[model samples]
Target: MMELFFKDFIMLWSTIDPVGTLALFTGLTARLSKSQKRKVALKATTYAFVILLSALVLGQIILKAMSIQLISLQLAGGIILFLFGLQMIFSDPEEGTGSREPGHQLAVFPLAVPSIASPGAIMAVIVLTDNNMKTFTQQAMTAGAMTSVLLITCGLMLIADRIFRVIGHNGSAIIIRVMGMILAALSVELVMTALGVQRWMS
Candidate 1:
C-alpha cells in the first residue's frame, strides 16, 4: 500500500511540479502588494483544489457520456497544455497588468484554472484513476496524491514573493521556457500514443 501511494505520489508530483508553478505564480502576482498577493494565492489554491477534486470524481463519466474516447481526450488535453506552455514561454509576464487596485479579489482565472487546476493536471488525474489498475484504495490514493500536490503548490505560492527575490524574473522566464519544451515533447508523445503507433523504435 505504501509503495503504491509512493508511486502515485511521484507520478502526480512530476506532472504537477508544484515548485515549477511557484515561479510562474510569483511572476504573475508580482505587481500586487504583500497582503493582496497572499489573499490571491490562498483564494486561487482553494478554488483550484475544489475544481480538481470534482473533476477527479466525475471526469470519466462526463467523458463517457459525451461519447469521448480516453485517447481523444488525452490528445485534446495535450494540445491545450502545449498551447498553455507556449504562452508561458513566450508571453510577457506583465501583458495583462491587472491594476484593479490592491484590495481586489483574485481567484479562478489566472491562478486556479490555468495555474493549479491545469488542463494537464485534470487529464492526468483522470488517466491515473483508470480502472485497469484495480482496487478502490488505489483509486483513492490517486485522489490523495492530487490533493497533496495542489496543497504543496498553494504553499509555494504563499511564499511567492520571497521566492521571486531569489530566482528573479529572468530566471523564472528561463524555467518556463524549459517547462514549455518538455510539455511540447510530452504532448507529441501523447498524440502518438493516441494514434496507436507504439514501438516506433523498430
Candidate 2:
C-alpha cells in the first residue's frame, strides 16, 4: 500500500506540477490585489479538485458513453492553452487584467483548466483509477495521492504573492512573457505527443 501510494504520489505530483501552476498563477494574477489573488488561488484549486475527482470517478464511463477519445481532450486543451499563452505574451503591460477578469471566470479558465486540472492531469487520474485495470484499494490510494498533491498546489498558490513580489512589478511582465513562450512550446508538445500516441496505438 505504501509503495502504491508513493508511486501514485510521484505520478500525480508530476502531472499536477504545483510549481508550474504557481508560476502560471503568478503570471495571470499579476495585477490583482492580495485578497483577489488569494480568492483566485483558492477558487482555482477547488475547481481543479472537483474536475479531477470527477475524472477519477466517472471519466471512463463518460468517455465511453460519449465515444470520446482522450486525444480529443488533449487536442482541445492544447489549442486553448496555446491561445492563452499567446495572449499572455502579447497582452499590454499597462492594462489591468485582474480588474477586467471576473473572479470566477478567471479562476475557472487557464488557471483551473489547463494549468491545474490539465489534460495531462485528467488523463493521469483516469488511467490511475481505471476500474478495469486497478483494484478498489489501489484506486483509493491513488485518490489519496491526488488529494495530497492538490492540497499542496493550493498551499503554494496561497503564498503566490510573495513569490510574485520576488519578481517585482517591473519583472512580472517579463516573467509572464517568458513563461508564455514556454507554455506555448509545452502546448505544442502536448498536441504532438497526443498525435504520436494515436499513431502508435493505431
Candidate 3:
C-alpha cells in the first residue's frame, strides 16, 4: 500500500510539475498586485483540483460509454500536451499579458488548463485510477495524492511574488521555455508508449 502511494505521488508530481506551474504563474501574474495574485492563485488551484477530481471519478465511465480505449486517450492527450508545450516554448510574454484580461481569464485559461490541470495530468489521473486495474481504496489514495500536489501548487502560487522577485521576469521566461521543451519530449514519449512503439522495439 505504501509503495502504491509513493508511486502515485511521484506520478502526480511529475505530471502536475509544480515548479513549472510556479514559473508560468510568476510570468502570467507578473503585473498583478499581491492581493489579486492571491485570488488568481486560489481560483486556479481550485479549478484544477475540481477538474482532476472529476476526471478521477467519472473519466472511466465516460470513456467506456464513448468506447474510447486507454491507448486512444493517451495518444489524444499526448497530442494536446505537445501542442501546449510548443505554445509555452514560443509564446511571447507580452502577448500573454496583453491578450487576456487580468483576473478571471488568467485564472481560467493557460494557468488552470494546460498549466495546472494539464492534458498529461488529466490523462495520468484517469490511467492511475482505472477501475479495472485499481481497487476503490487505491483510487481514493491516488485522489489524495493528487489533491496534495495541487495544494502544494497553490502554496507555491501564493508565494509567487517572492519567486518572481528572486528569479525576475527574464529568468522565469527562460525556465518556462526550458520546461516546455521537456514537456514536449515527455509528450512524444507518451505518444510512443500509447502506440506500443517501445514494446514493439523491445
Best by lDDT: 2
Candidate 1 C-alpha lDDT tens digits along 77-161: 6676667677767877566555665423336654676556766677777877876665778889888878888788878888777
Give the lDDT of residue 139 in candidate 1: 87
Q: By TM-score, how accurate is candidate 1?
A: 0.73
lDDT of 1: 0.71
Off by over 4 Å in 2: 93-102, 197-202
Clashes (backbone N, CA, C under 3 Å), per candidate, total 0, 0, 0
lDDT of each: 0.71, 0.86, 0.84
Ranking by TM-score: 2, 3, 1
Error of 3 at 72 (Å): 2.5
RMSD of each: 3.7, 2.6, 2.8
Report the Cα lDDT for residue 59, model 3.
Answer: 83
Report the C-alpha lDDT of model 3 over 1-202, residue by residue, as the tens digit. 8888889999999989898888778766776778889999999999999999998999889988999876786687678768877987998856645444457777987678867887778888999998888999999999989998999999999988887778776786787688678769878998999899999999
lDDT of 1 at 64: 80
lDDT of 3 at 201: 96
